[model samples]
Target: MLNALDNLTRLISFDSVSKNSNEPISDYVSSLLEELNFEVERTTYMDARGVLKCNLLACRRPLSSHPKLDETQSSSASDEETSPKNAPGGLAYFCHTDTVTADRWTGPGGDPFSAIVLDGRVYGRGACDMKGSLVAFLDAARKTPHEEQKLPLWIACTADEEVGFEGARFLTENSNAYTELVAADPVSIIGEPTMLHVIHAHKGICGMQIRSQGHAAHSSTDMGVNANVAMVPMLQTLLEIHNRCLTDEALRNDAFDPPTLTWNFGVSDGMKTVNIVPDHSNAWASMRTMPGVDGKDIIEQVKRRADELGLTFTLYSGGDPMHTDAEAPFIREFCELASTYIGPNSPEAVCYATDACAFGQLQHRVVCGPGSISQAHTTDEFIEIEQLETGIRFYEDTIRRWCC
Candidate 1:
């Protein structure tokens, strides 16, 4: 059987960047799932740039569909005990197939896609955040035969996660596996780089842009409407709001580190020369939304300020904050497993968002996996070899605990 490292090496070779089509990587994953006798659902969509992207949802035992019982699976357990009705839930693992841009890769090698093993680590883009985590789940799925699954074992690889989770949003409506996974209400995992630590909740993602338009003219003519000048009021308003987010206790929660919305925005102008007046300027901002906080309230405040300044305010995207009660049964049980395998551990809250935000229907979802968030998207991204083995074992144990 191929180990996680073996599989990750091949997977890292693919440049599944956010701006490019993920068909190639998705195809390879689809092939692997098929070879494992998994029932696969492939969903495709055209990105904003009209590039084709793909999402894959594969199950070892697809809900009420099971075939060809492995003798080993049956020998250890009775058929009655193996009935789907007896099994309360299965496991669902979520990962993104797309990675961030690797144009700045400056590791030992020039090729970011060419994965290398050095100093007991695997180096490459997405190695930790998280093709490595994905491969670990794949290894576990490979070991867990379909015939042995008393419940479903789901694996979802979404596209465009680096670019606002577009594929996850797409599959939330289009994929049958997503439909079934939601209906199953199984405990789901968003396999980001958590260093194998469980994450109970994470902040959501939201952004808006305020644009000011004006006519360009020579500076000497004084006939041009400088968009930058018109944006002054909005800039002041944003600064005020930004400070509130940073310091206002009422606008924050203690459950998350930094607790605040962590809102940030930047101003940009298209002006080229000092002699010419700028015709266009815009301010784009994003906030990491938290639960119990009305992020929209802040957004509306910004919008109203733009209206007062006679500027256009556009809310471009919003992914709801992912939260599951840390006291939930599934979480407690998972913690117990963590204690046994990875030592004493508690569910943590991360500042970053994951695909879980889009598939918010799965209330029991948690974000956890190998590698560290610090290593994610770094110029020399890598995962320690130790994490790969431990991640595989943890996933295998989780699969057996829930499915077998």
Candidate 2:
């Protein structure tokens, strides 16, 4: 309710990059949610760097006192609507407060955190990737009066989604509010940059690395061992996997662009000069995991290859794909709502994963919000004013349909 545009501007200034502690921005968001009469739930955890990060789940119920859950009840929608007023069933929205680094900011002002509105677009570090969507949903939820909310409304803000969905995973496993949200069987939306289209499925991500260590010595010395030599076999195995994925129809999902599990790799050695034998070498590989592909098998194969060569293999991440029935009744209804604004359409699929990856416990969920995905994490990220306004109406309609 406190000026939404001003909130967007303020959020952009926080510099809540994935590496930095998001406590400052979380504090401001918690205060705003509290002001909106939501009972704010907080979860805090230290990152690998030991910096404290926070996740928030704010619940706002109807004006009718507090709603307590009934153990004997199932989370069926028809039963829930008539079961109890101010019950823990309705709508929920999710957004991550962190953004990718802006080290390469090339906007007009050359400062990523200094939000600027130019030519009807708001530009900043997270203007489109997510801060804009977060503000949009918060504003819409606040617009709905407490009296209209027959069921509870939930707004969740997470940390470290861009890095590895750590905050979301932590919240789902640790937060009491998250348990209630999942139990309520509420329809949830992950407000990633989706150009306002309803998304029912998305690809997952996987990362792996192989490292080899050797003693460093001058290139002219005969006693030196090059770690890169040990990595040669692992690199070949990676190429084989990548080539197979490129043409493997069994691993493809036509719903996504390019359809196949895309692969990329990077090899690095610490040696600054080629004249020295590298003491250590590492080869990192990542791939997009589609629904049908067995990502775990691919990881195991790479690990075995590394082990056969006496190299250290690390599984940076397993695939965490999110998929819901595209033909489900709730999904159909949500798509209808989206069509009212964007004109006739069906639910979509995205190649990129979202915080939804960690929220698999929730039954009914979708990914949809304002802004095009192309602008996310770019040097000059911006969200058009039109898209932001449209996003508010879409989210408000979502809230009214379930909560009111």
CA error at residue 161 for candidate 1, angstroms: 0.6
Tens digits of per-residue lDDT for model 2 on 1-404? 46778899999999899999999999999998998898999999999999899999998877874575454322553322344432336889999999999999999788999999999999999999899999999889878887887777889999999998999989988999888888786788999989889999998999988999888889999788889998998899999999988887787889899798898888999677878889889999998887777467778899999999889988875437888888876788888889877998999888889999888777778999999899998999999988998899999999998889
TM-score of 1: 0.93
> Clashes in model 1: which pairs?
196-369
**Steric clashes per prediction:** 1, 0
**Which parts of model 1 are misplaced by more than 4 Å?**
62-88
lDDT per residue for candidate 1 within 1-404, as digits (tens), equals 46678789889999998988999999998988888877889999999889999999987784455443332322221113345443335788999999999999997677899999999999998899889999998898887766777767788999999999899999998987777677666668888988778899999989999999988899999799999988988888889989889888888989999899998999999666898889989998899988888577888898998888889999976689988888766787788887766789998898899888898777668888988899999999999988988888889888988887
Please, what is the whole-model Cα lDDT of each candidate in the order they appear?
0.84, 0.86
Candidate 1: worst-modelled 10 consecutive residues by lDDT: 71-80
Q: What's model 2's overall lDDT? A: 0.86
